[model samples]
Target: MALSGELWADLSAERRIFCSVLLFSWTVYLWEAFLAHRQRRVYRTTTHVPQELGQIMDSETFEKSRLYQLDKSTFSFWSGLYSEVEGTMILLCGGIPFLWKLSGQISGHAGFGQEYEIVQSLVFLLLATLFSALTGLPWSLYNTFVIEEKHGFNQQTLGFFFKDAIKKFVVTQCILLPVTSLLLYIIKIGGDYFFIYAWLFTLVVSLVLVTIYADYIAPLFDKFIPLPEGELKQQIETMAKSIDFPLTKVYVVEGSKRSSHSNAYFYGFFKNKRIVLFDTLLEDYSSLNKEQTEGEDGENEETKSKTKNKKQGCKNEEVLAVLGHELGHWKLGHTVKNIIISQVLSFCLTVLSRRFEFQADAFAKELGKAKDLYSALIKLNKDNLGFPVSDWIFSMWHYSHPPLLERLQALKDAKQE
Candidate 1:
């Protein structure tokens, strides 16, 4: 049967709406993914110096070069433009899908005159989300296994990675499915009025999650135990006391079981405050220190043999210096400022989270231990060298955090003052 011109017009309009919405969503997703890839390259390059700090032939020149690369990268006029592009794409990716789906469902309901269209809409939304996540998993695998492994950073077995992924999926579904269902129910009942209450609920939940992440959530994946009895523990306690940073707990995390990279973090607030040092860090620091003592009289056959044997320690001084740098971040109000700045930026720029990272690095220096911080920074850079610097810089700028080199330079500048 030949359709009337008016009916043809209506059909054409529906096709246009569907295609436009889907095309817009996919375009946004692709743009975001591209920008994120660029940012990651930048950050990876910048932090590479820190990972290799111990292996550098000349520390001073290497430090200067690292700082120069960082400054050059951060202050480049093009960098800001790239930064803006990355940021804008992220917001579009996050918001566009929701809007497209919502509008499509509304239009579908009007056209079909059927309640089942709403269910279809919800199903579409879920499928979109699932598909997005599924597409991301392959890239995640590539990064963790191929890219990281090439750079000597990947210590995780394929089994470990998949196991972790499955566990995470289960945990996320357990938490998110119920929350999402509830939110949708509220939206169905209250319509636009539910947004205000939904926002409030989201805010409260986010705060609660942050508070409990270290104590409850973190333990699910890794083991944590009190910092062992030793001079290391005493030094940490003494430093905490000296800085008037009340410390009730310090724990060593089982990070080495998963990777060779070492890290230390400070977490919790008020009475719950604690410090966690990676077991790898402790082992490496101790080994390096032992090597230095053996090589004290320059090069000799016996000394060389001893040095080779004692490759697991770091100087106690360096450890203290690194700890001091972390403490500096807290003592100088960097953490609080970061939280506030992040919230404000989330509303305004939506991408300033990465820039704020550089500011935190500057704050870390103001707290003391600049030399140790520099050494630690160098070591971190060297260890992470395989990832392209550009990817690291831009990725962190796009989503996660800040570039390592920028942070190190900020510390250097702070130390000079």
Candidate 2:
């Protein structure tokens, strides 16, 4: 007891904190691995469509979803293990402080000197992010090329992928470096309430980014065009006007250029609100239709025929139903509520997020969109090859929205009522 006490006493606060952080990180990782194991078990054993899923999913689709999820789970396991081991090694080897000193030296060589702590800090941040990107690159490439390509989700050619990646890195650095510099400067000059100032600064930055992302940053990568005049546009405008949603413009982003996944969202504050829809979400306008008409490069008739048979997107009414759900978010103040709660009460976030989704679903139901939304949900899930089933614990930890079946049930109940 005396020897143990003496040893514990000899451990400095910094050493204790360092060891504690490592212990906590590993503990979290192990917990995640265990959760993943349970989910993977479900993926492996649930080979056929369950009685509950029979109506919504066919045997072929279910099997494809099962295999896709299994592959994703396997990939996640290896990537997660690699990340955990890398983090542990970095901490054990004092990688952070070592990199900090190296960054200082680099800045000094560039005539910035140690007194320019901001410059050294920027150098350190850049080096850190670059290191992270480099280390994760192989896993990313494997996911995009091997896993996603095999599953028919990957759309970018190797050249396009690399070009896009480089563009993203450059744009990210341009934004990150300046923002971090400003943040560090604020901290240095803020004195006692640096935390408060930092929080406010981040809040402002987030709002600004949300407001400008679709307009400025997003268009830098993907193409965005105004939703052309049509029946769909007219109906959407009518729906918006009915709810006083402050909808200003609608855009159809060519998201199919990267992936076949469909999505839609509204952004901006007050009257400047704009809705952006992935081109993949519109049955009529979807680029997936092209696959039916023409063969891709190097694709033979057999491959082209297989691709052509794969349908994507939703009907017009279903698209309107999706818009109804999205508009519900705006009308119900879910977005603003979430932002505030996320910044303040983060612990309750996951549960509250799920609740918010349900509320939005209910609002859509109230808009007489229950049946359309239900069908839309199933179609979207099938198109994305999303695994409808989830482990309870995993769902609790990770899913912000309720599972497909649960939402469908809720919508059905609402419709019946």
Instruction: List the pairs of residues colliding in candidate 2.
Output: none
Clashes of each: 50, 0
Worst 10 residues of 1 by lDDT: 299-308
Candidate 1 error regions (>4 Å): 1-135, 188-192, 283-315, 332-367, 386-417
lDDT of 2 by residue, 201-235 (tens): 99999888988888899999987999999999999
TM-score against truth, every candidate = 0.62, 0.95
Q: Candidate 2, residue 17: CA error in Å?
A: 1.2
The whole-model lDDT of each prediction reads 0.59, 0.88
Report the lDDT of model 2 for residue 351: 90
Angstrom error of the Cα, residue 164, model 1: value is 1.9
Per-candidate RMSD, Å: 10.9, 3.0
